[model samples]
Target: MAGVRTSLRRSAPALLIFAAIRALGLVTLILWSHAKGKDPHQLLSARWDSLWYVRVAEHGYDFTLTAPDGRVLSDMAFFPLLPWLEQGVSAISPLGFADSGLLVSALASLFAAWAIFLIGDLLHGRRVGITLVALWGMLPVGIVQSMAYSESLFVALSAWSLYWVLRQRWVAAGILASPAGLTRPVGLAVVAALWVAAACQLARRNGDWRAAANRRMVIGAVLAPLGCAGYVVWVGLERGSLFGYLDVQAEWGNGFDGGVAFAGFILDRLTGPAFLAGAGLLIGVAVAAWAYYLCVKQRQPAALLVYCGIVVGLALCASGYFGSKPRLLMPAFPLLLPPAVWVARARVGVIVAVLSAVSVGSAVYGAFWLNGSGPP
Candidate 1:
């Protein structure tokens, strides 16, 4: 209890910074929505994946939508944890699923921010940790952090899981990672990181792989994959095929083909009328590649590198909904560590000024976005 209190107090600054960032996004959304004659709360609490989660929470996962092309869109494609929490919260509270989800996302994002801070504080210091939280809040798609989505929950789980891995708390890491797997398909990255870290430890141990340390590692390794595997297996049985989950994803035109499909997407864009969009795609890809190179150069911990690499690989290689690439990559928080280190050394006031400006831009963009085309 004392430790928890101390940790909270230490994290207070980062939490406040996170809150301020989110508040700016919310206020911007409200003002923008007022100008456009739309409900800001509706935009945040119900739309896109937010609506899908509410459907799941209120109606359960026994729903599917079939397009005229015979493509099947099933609720099963959505992960279960966020909706499960929404259902549980709505059951007791007067709030509906949408409101419950917004509440969950809002709170989860704060926890996610704190977890990011813990990793930063451990790797660098409290200042760096605070910067990391601010940087995360300022990401272009950071507005999604406030919506009723699973990104916040998944990031929270992933960050804490990574923190536990860094602390060598094998079982605890695995325990947290289990829910992460249930939150998003990329949760596999966390599982892989834990396994890679454990394997590296065993390799370094030379012998006595069955020692206490190795035993804990073994237990964690076994536990870490359970959430993903269990869900996939259940999906398989429910759908009456071992590859049912994959098939469902394929029905939605989402698949990993070693970036072949994604490369084709970029190529198609170049051939289309949207030449500017094509240019933007290329620039985005280049930026991602450069940031990853920095991670490698920084020689981040193997667990972090493995986790980040898998997250990026999955986000970039996925075939459809190319627009979601930014939001999908949002959970790869470690990628910001390189930049956060640089920002931490600057004048605090200067850093805040820069981030505040970026925060406004992100907020304006987010409001305009949700009120228009919306997330795919």
Candidate 2:
């Protein structure tokens, strides 16, 4: 217990810094939303991206929208884990649906910060942990931490699963990976990482797997697929179509095929010398390259590959939901750690002060300029 308390004390400064950054970002979001004629409470409960999550929490998956072309769109299109959490919270708390969702996300964001600290500590050290958590809190899209989004929840689950895997706790790793899958499609990446790690361990012993170990691995693998599979099954039963979720995504212009087509379209537009479009493209490419560089320099090749593949694949393959690119990239947060660590090492106070200023500005822009729109 003394050792645990000591460890917590060591991490306290990082956690406090992380909390301060997120709080500033949240304040900016609230103020900007207020400026936009949106009440803070209403903004918290607004029927935008958050509405689908609330609906699922309150009512379960009962609604369906069919396009004119007979395409069936099911509420099951949204994953179940987040809503289920919201439902659980509402059941126990006096908070209404919106407040419940907000509370869940807010707590999840803090959990994500802790998880980031753990992952960074494992990969680098306590310094890196502090830097990584600070960077996550200061990201331009960091407003998602305060929103009723699943990014924070998913990150918390993924990071903890990775930590468990690193500690060789196969059963715990598997259990965490399961809900991760339910949270987002990208949870499969965590599943894949765990599977690979487990397989390597098993193979090293010449297939002389212990019964207990084998059972644990099997459970982990099973858990990983449950969330996604359960959603599909529910959609199929309710809508009479196994492809109901896909169809709904299509209507939202988010079918997966490869982002090459969308890239081509964007390129064509840039060929016409549209200054704003060109500038946007340039910024996007620069950010992507910087992320890629961090991945390479940090020697986290596997994490980099997984994040790049998912982000690029989703961006290209989805039909028309290009607006979600920012949100989709939010999960590639591990890539940010290396750069943040570098920043922290170079006069930590200066770096943090700069980040705090930027976080506040970005949060304000997200709430007001973007209207809490886009993937961010």
Residue 13 in model 1: shift from native, Å?
0.9
RMSD, each candidate, Å?
Answer: 1.3, 3.0
Q: Across residues 172-226, which tens digit of lDDT does each residue of candidate 2 receive? A: 8878877888988777777777777777777776766667877676677667666
lDDT to native, each model:
0.90, 0.72
How many residue pairs clash in model 1? 0
Residue-level lDDT for 40 in candidate 2: 62
Each prediction's TM-score versus the true structure:
0.97, 0.87
Best by TM-score: 1
Which candidate leads in lDDT?
1
| Worst ten in a row by lDDT for model 2 | 301-310
lDDT of 2 at 281: 62
* Candidate 1 lDDT over residue span 1-376, tens digit each: 9988998999999999889988988898899999999998988888888988999988888998997989989989998999999999999999999999999999999999999999999999999999999989978788899999999999999999999999999999999999999999999999999999988888889856678887888898889989988899889999999999999899988999888887887888899998787788889888888898999998899899999999999999898888898888899899999999998899979888888898889888877777786473
